[model samples]
Target: MRLLLENKQFRIFWIAGVFSDLALITYFTVHGWLALQVSDSAFWVGATSGAGGLSLTMFSVFGGVLVDRFGRRSLVLVGLLIRFVIALALVALIMTENIALWHVLLAAFGEGLAVSFLMPAMMALTLDVAGRGKLLSATAARFAGMTVAGIIAPLAAGSIVNSAGIEWAYVMIALGFSASAGFMLILRPPNPAKRTNSSPLEDLKQGVTYVIRTPQIRMLIAMIFITEAFGWAHESMLPVMARDVLHVGATGLGYLLAAGSAGATVTTVIISNMGDIRNKSNMLVGGCIGFGFFLVLFAWSQWLLLSLAFLAGAYAAVIVYETTINTLLQTSVPDELRGRVLSFQAMMWGVTGLAGFHTGAIASAVGAPVAIAIGGGVVILNSLRIARHRSQLDPDLAQSSLDSESIDSRGDQPES
Candidate 1:
């Protein structure tokens, strides 16, 4: 941890990551509520959420290919600048009463496009800075920021939206993006040793091929997609849960989300200090099962206090599962393909949005509890399959000849 802090570049990037997550969390919460208020239809809310993440489906492969071909820093700056501008634009449009569902949807599409590029670059750079030796700690530190931002952003956005209106939440979102971009300016990854002169299409093809050829990574990506699609996508139902089940207003919704994220934050801090452990595979599999059980229980609970307790447990298990997988991926993949692999990871968010669309449609027909319970069931089944293949889930690649391959898992190796 001290080594990570002593490295100036990644330290700045960590701060940048927190700021950007603040912007995104606030924007999503504010925009989701606005969509519901404007349309009064759960489907529209799902559509809007789907639209935001769906934009990534169009751009992530290209973004991933480009980041590896060129570099990370400049791409990150441009992406954040565009996001900041879009946030400011939304604030202006909303304040002027010129906003409509289409306008908001347009803004959302723009946000997704920017994020598809930004996140891959930022994560790849993080791995670059931390090197192979510190991958576990560094990845934990990065997500520690995520858990904190989750804790704070929802409650803050909820309060602002309830008091000052949604536009002010957006305004703060813009400021967060600007601050994040400013911190990014100080980051400088070590220069590449060679250039790839191949066309973008060829490079993209190579990346895809590499992922397919690697069994463990392929399995990992599959789990990431399934879990995101069914597990965490339940946020699409939160507004309805607040209105129908909990009878909590938006403020109460904020508190409920904060409770869940607070649990995740505490869990992240606790595990970040665990140093190294050998049972990561079992924990990864077991955590997903635990997340499923807790989620179903939370959905069934009609009491707010009881529901909150279950939600907290659900998020704790989720963080445990997600963090272990992500850390293992970072340590396992070679640096040359890191950007592309991470971008594919980013694509899971899009899958969640699409799955949320279906989940919402199901909820509209069957109710939130039924839809969430089905999702939990699916998460359990899919994660069980992953556990069945737990031998391939090893992060150190101890059983593979590729472990002996001359691959620089760390992008930067500046000499003393």
Candidate 2:
């Protein structure tokens, strides 16, 4: 905490992250409810959510290019500003009672695009502020912030939507985004590496090539893609299950989702206090396997209490795995290439998540239980494959594969 407080840029960045994430979570919770109200069809709700993921998947590579070319701070500032404007437009549409399904879809897509850029830039900037020596703690702090927002937003949005209206919830999110953008505008971090003259496209290509050639990064990326595609589909399907299957209302669904967030928050806080753990590869593999198991249990649960418990456990495992993998990547990759690589990572997640969203829609049609069960099975199988190939998947292998220019020339050498 002291280390975090010592870095002015990092403090600013954390504040920005909190605000942006709060807005995002609030939007997602309220949007899901609004879609259900308007369409009265689970399939459409899934598709409405899927649309945003689809947009993010399509534009993530470009988001990476923008971050690498224009710089992390610039990309974040631009993305947040765009989000603020988009949010205001949404407010106008809602106030005029002129909103349609297409307008909602457009707003979701725009938010998705902003996220595609903002995520990678934020990761890169966090690394820049933390430096190599403190990467683990920094990553933990970022995840902790996200967990806090995730936990708070759903309950808050639910209350607002139930009492005031969905539009008020959206208005709250817009204000959050506006405040985040303001903080970002004032943030200026010292550049630790010299700038390059290469085009953004070239830089993006280089980043992708670097990941593809590195066995560890490639394996990790593959794992995340599979985990997101299969293990995390529950999020996309939860609302449908709560309403159609469990006979739960919006408030009940909010509480169910909040249970998972609470678990994730607890995990983040615990990890943050523990400092860095060794054998990060083991942590990644074990956490993912745990995540898959809990997902299976959650899918099969008939009792609400059982379902909530399983969801909470699964979410906590995901938080552990995600935070560990991100720290590994930050510590393993070169500072110069961090922006592009993080962007590529974000892109892979977006694409995989998009696939998951569609899969959820298909699953909802067939029966939520069967779909979730199949997804959980796939997650277990994929995680086992990664564990078996740990040697190839470990980020430490990047030490040998990365070219000189792939990392910052002056950054710390690989620890012997």
Best by TM-score: 1
Q: Where does candidate 1 stray beyond 4 Å?
A: 1-4, 191-194, 395-416
**lDDT (tens digit, per residue) of candidate 2 on 274-332:** 77676677778888888888888887787788888888898898888998889877777
Q: Candidate 2: deviation at residue 322, Å?
A: 0.2
Question: Clash number for model 1?
Answer: 0
TM-score of predicted model 2? 0.90
Q: Tell me each candidate's TM-score.
A: 0.92, 0.90
Query: How does model 1 fare in lDDT?
Result: 0.80
List the global CA lDDT of all models.
0.80, 0.77
Off by over 4 Å in 2: 192-194, 395-416
List, residue by residue over 1-416, the lDDT tens digit for candidate 1: 45445778778778988999898878767777788788887777777778877897778888888778876888888998998898888888888998899987787788878878887887777767777666666777777888789889989988998898888998899999899888877777664313488888988998899888998889888898888888877887777787778888777777778778878887778776777666578878988998888888988888999888888899889888887887777667777777788888888877777776888798888888888888888899988888877868875434442544434444345667
What RMSD value applies to candidate 2? 6.0
